[model samples]
Target: MAARRASHAGSWYSDEAKHLGKQLDNWLSAADLCHGPARAIIAPHAGYQYCGACSGFAYRQISPVVVRRVFILGPSHHVRLSGCALSTFTKYRTPLYDLRIDAQVYRELEATGHFEWMNMSVDEDEHSIEMHLPFIARVMENFKDSFTIVPVLVGSLTPDKEGLYGRIFSRYLADPQNLFIISSDFCHWGHRFRYTYYDRSWGEIYQSIRNLDKMGMDIIETLNPSGFTDYLKKYGNTICGRHPIGVLLQTVHSLQKSGNNGHKVSLKFLKYAQSSQCCSLSDSSVSYAAAALTFE
Candidate 1:
């Protein structure tokens, strides 16, 4: 079977299995399982040095024994896509181990006729999906052979398209044995990113960014996709994975609407951090947040 190489392994993270495994174990060990046994998670996809520790808060919540499949939905950074695309490779190689792609789930999604197939080059070039592979491998190591993954590259989509894909994935989301991992980073602030919105009342520039991101996070926790859309429009926050996040919100909404109201699903953010503190207009910083979606 063909495999997609861990393209960013050496630079973004360690390529050696032993060293990388130890690093990930330290991060996971440091995190407390506040809201656990997550059905889904929203975690950052930056390099190990930047978001690795923050991502632990989200991954630590997983109950690996029960999971049979992992659905990774990440933004398409290199290619322009109007809808979602699935990986053609049978497996994704990581420093830790190779993760098998669920061909059965792929065929089922393909039968829906709404998804697209990503070529090997595009699949390998994208870092958003690949960054989560190591963490997924670490968190589910004991049950490694039992679970297969479905990686979906989400494109820039309209609100209607988000709802469409959300409805398509809702059936899989309903299954307790399936885990959804939404890859995203929060606000990208400063002139380099061409965004410099700061409220002086918030005291420091980073403080302002935190408050701004907090507002959006609060809205996301409510599971209101329209509200999130409005927040994006109002602030124009450079949330690269907004579309994927929107799709997850709509998935929960779709589930609740489809008579799954009795099964309560709640999303809560556990950690937040920035690459740097943007104290001035010239400084740039990328925010990272970790959240868990749990069913009560």
Candidate 2:
């Protein structure tokens, strides 16, 4: 079936099929691709060299011969999307392989009155979700049929709106067979990103930035919902996708409580490295992290 083509193939990742597949294999083999039965993954959306390893950890763990359907949620980076955007395409094209969207479930969620717009068109050029696909393809050979997706973009989600989208998404993916994913980069630091005050250069300043990100990390480590919001508002820590993370956590909490047995949510930090930490450029860079949270 003809569907959307790869938009970020050359820029964010490799455009060549062999290079893409080979690198995907190497990265997949390196991470915890076979970790315990998982329910959700929080992966980054930055460039391949920068954040690929971190993002690969979650996708590799969740995709290998298990699970069906992943509800990928990310914020609108290029354009501010209104409401949640569902994929109108039958299949999502990735450099590694194609993954289908669960049409039946998509239509079902569409009927729910909790959210508005249903801006399915926003998936076009939406690399937040697309970036995770190649990693998924590397793990699940029959990925197209093995797992489907309910791709949604979180753009302008107010508190009320996030709750609304959470409920609708909860209902749609409540089945025991599904997984959830929230695509996000933890914090953007440095003067270039404007997340930190020490602007000239963060060379070894990651120590200071680390202290700042600790505010966000504490919330993640302790699952402190309120403090997380407080820190985000106070520091203006351009996390870019806190809306999706909050809604996913909130939804998972509700779903487990209402289920026969509570769903388990555990977030593990796979890798945490800033561009400045790893590269010569320390003056202006973003903090990149890879983490996987399981919704049991």
Pick by lDDT: which candidate is best?
1
lDDT of 2 by residue, 135-223 (tens): 76666666566678777777767666666666666654466567777888866765566555443353455665665665576676555
Clashing pairs in 2: 33-60, 263-296, 264-296
Q: What is the lDDT of residue 114 in candidate 1?
A: 91
Question: Which numbered prediction scores highest in TM-score against the true structure?
Answer: 1
Q: What TM-score would every model get versus the actual structure?
A: 0.99, 0.86
- Model 1 lDDT at residue 176: 93
Off by over 4 Å in 2: 33-35, 114-122, 172-174, 198-204, 256-260, 278-282
Q: How much is the lDDT of residue 257 in candidate 2?
A: 55
Give RMSD (Å) of candidate 2 vs. truth: 3.2
**Clash totals in order:** 0, 3
Kindly give the stretch of ten consecutive residues in candidate 1 with the minimal lDDT sum.
256-265
Residue-wise lDDT of candidate 1 within 23-85, one digit each (tens)?
999999999999978999999999989999999999999999889999999999999999999
- Model 1 misplacement above 4 A: none
